[model samples]
Target: MTEQLEKLNRLPLRDDLRGLTPYGAPQLDVPILLNVNENTHGLPQEVQDAITASVQRAVSGLNRYPDREFTELRTRLAGYLGHGLGIENIWAGNGSNEVLQQILQAFGGPGRTAMSFPPTYSMYPLLASGTGTRYVTGDRAADFTLSAESAAEQVRAAAPNIVFLCTPNNPTGTALGLDVVEAVYEAGTASDAIVIVDEAYAEFSHAGTPSALELLPGRERLIVSRTMSKAFALAGARLGYLAAAPEVTDALRLVRLPYHLSAVTQATANAALAHADALLANVEDIKVQRDRIVAELTELGLQPAASDANFVFFGGVEDPKRIWQGLLEAGVLIRDVGIPGHLRVTAGTEAETTAFLTRLRELLGA
Candidate 1:
């Protein structure tokens, strides 16, 4: 394996990608999985049966090409969002990452730049690289918060063609306030940039926090991307969507591969949507677990960033990897997000949360 990898590296490769490592998080099988911010509680039994039936219906269509426009899926998704959106205002891909790539393909390229404020989602930079778009990242506060003034100032300086704001940000679970989004949009107007607010974890945010969808009325350049993969427990389904102006989705159509969403994918997602209430019944319980983690971690003398997402990012470790290894030895798996003193953990079931907290406290001798 080593020799083959070394030989492959010697072959011709893109100059930009020659030394870059692939995106990944540790995927270990353990007693508890809180690494990837996935919902451990699964779909309700009724939803599962509906989804199975739907996919079974779609199996016969395997001989035919899927819907070229994915019209039905788009319509159903739009209805689910319910912010005065229509089919023309929605787009879907294999995942939110792909939809993001399509956005870069349409608006960013060699001479253009895509800017983010990290540490946010790791994929933003990789997506830029894959699309040949220059990637740049601005700084956030020590607490991992991005203020309106800071966002505006950075946007002005970068003057990028694409701006990514990952709300309920990955790695750090902090969410950006709407003021920051508005500030960035106002500041970037002079640069003609498209501002993408990634809300993959929106559903898990604290109650009464308005969605970026509420701000879509007049902002033509604003894009809010969401996914069924996270809160919907549909990661295996691979359906990510975005909502924007009709023209924004219209532009995406020009760049997306024809019939990218398959019949099976469409049927499964549509069925899941029909049982959305049942599928989402676990959210409140997950929130309780997430809150418990934050409080317990703080009580242990570590600082956890105030999170609005499914996971919590905590600091105050002397050696992150050492602690990570300790947890792994106890059969728990969380993420070491490469931050100096921080680690991230997703909220699982109540028992899983208890197991994680117990093992972590034991590791720290607390």
Candidate 2:
């Protein structure tokens, strides 16, 4: 065998990954894709024009490396964040995932803990492993609400260095209300742990739900992570950021790669920012479609969680995997989350939603 192959075989990988199945996002080429929570709409024509113009300006500087600081991009992002917080509080990465990893690297490692909730984003646990940090979880209540007391107990017991809370949580589509989040945040603070709120779906949240950013005052240990991937429809460009106090941003900057955000990505995100109104309009439409899908699922005898995000989680029927398989065969792909008796589906375009509903009704004999 080659020298590289010999060394690879001899080296022992992380102990936790032993026998753990590798993860790859599902591959489904269908007329309707409801598996991943992606906005079905592309950037508007006006936004595309802006991107083209920005790209032209950037092309002349191809010989130079991207700005190591991503200062211009940060300025645009700080502007996006508005006067509420300035550039001192912002950190960006290739994606929100990387930003999350940097948080772990900065504060978490062997002998330290990273706490999260179950049926939340799977990436949290994976990210923890990459930093050699212990991953601890508090299971949500049966109704999918965050158990503030239980979470508090875990914080005290684990004494974790970092705690991740997913707002309008993934896989279940349930929003942990601000009061509960505050309770958890308070509990976590008792241990002097950092609380990272993963608000990847905040744009689709129900009105009146307070954003974590709005609650960041005096919460110096808090990091509210946001992504342009979901609401801005820029997943392809890979931009995500965290808003926190200057100290936290400084620590994150220490571990993050120098040129993590590319000029192309920075430019694309700036273009997207200029069309915020159009993006919010699309988000509202998704929310409307999400509500309708939840209702339709209920009428078909499926109990869906009260979702404030753009996806719906419904199940309690026979064999969610079999149902998911049937839907896939019928060309409608939904996410079969590992959670038993539960499946998550993203709301697509109106026509796509209709097609999925029709096929689902036929499959379930509704």
Candidate 3:
């Protein structure tokens, strides 16, 4: 490995990317996968049939490049989002990561800056770096929470060209109040910055926790990104999209490769959206497991944060590494997230959840 790495460094790689590692999590073959926060319920049979049929039809058009605009996919996504959005207001890419990368490509670059609060999504910094945008880290409270006031103040201080706000934040599973979004937008106006609300886990948010999509009516500079990967149970399909002002989509077109979204991807996403209700039924079940994890962890005297996404993040572990390893040996895999005394677990099906909880209890001797 050392020799290969040394050889890789011999290439004339870009200076900024010289030592950077790609983003990923462990893909172990375990009986239970509670890591990566995937919707482990698997797709309903009906949605599966729909996607397969859609792709079968799209296969005939493989000889031609896909619709560069991906018009019907955008329309379906807009209808699904439904905040008075139209096709012009929607844009898509391979996944929410690519959607975010495109945003950085369009609005962030050399001499420009992008900021995001930490203990949040890990990808924000990577995307900034990949796009040559200077990455800036903003502070969060010791508890890993960011209040509206603190967020707004941080924006004013950074004066960045772009801002990423990940709600139901990754690695912690805490959702932000829309007031934080509103406040950050107000603060960013000084720099004419583009504010992105990454709602990759929005569909799994606890009831009555409103989405940033509600704030899109007049906030032209604000972008709300969503994905079919989670609640839609289409992670393998890799369809992620955003709702923004029409002009924002136009701006993205300037940087996106021609025919970036393939015909089959558009077809799969359209079919999944067609069955949104069936797929979302699983979301409700996952939420039950998520809440159960939180309640059980609290009962165990551990510190589980208030979760609005499909996962739970908790501390109070005397030995996180030991617990993680014990679970792995028992064929259960969850995320350690590089945080001392803490771990994150996705809420899977009932049996999967039970397996994880059972193994965890044995490890903790609770």
Best by lDDT: 3
Q: For residues 54-93, what per-residue lDDT tens digits would candidate 1 score against the true structure? A: 9999998899999988888998999999989999899999
What residue pairs are clashing in model 3? none
Q: How close is candidate 2 to the true structure, as a TM-score?
A: 0.94
Task: Give the residue spans of candidate 1 off by over 4 A.
Answer: none
Ranking by TM-score: 3, 1, 2
Tell me model 2's lDDT, rounded to 2 decimals: 0.84
Q: Which stretches of candidate 3 lie over 4 Å from their true place?
A: none
lDDT of 3 by residue, 206-298 (tens): 879999999998889999999889999888989899999999999999999989999999999889889989999999999999999999999
Distance (Å) between predicted and true CA of 348, model 1?
0.7
Q: Residue 176 error for model 3, in Å?
A: 0.9
Residue 183 error, candidate 2, Å: 1.9
Query: Candidate 2: which pairs clash?
Result: none
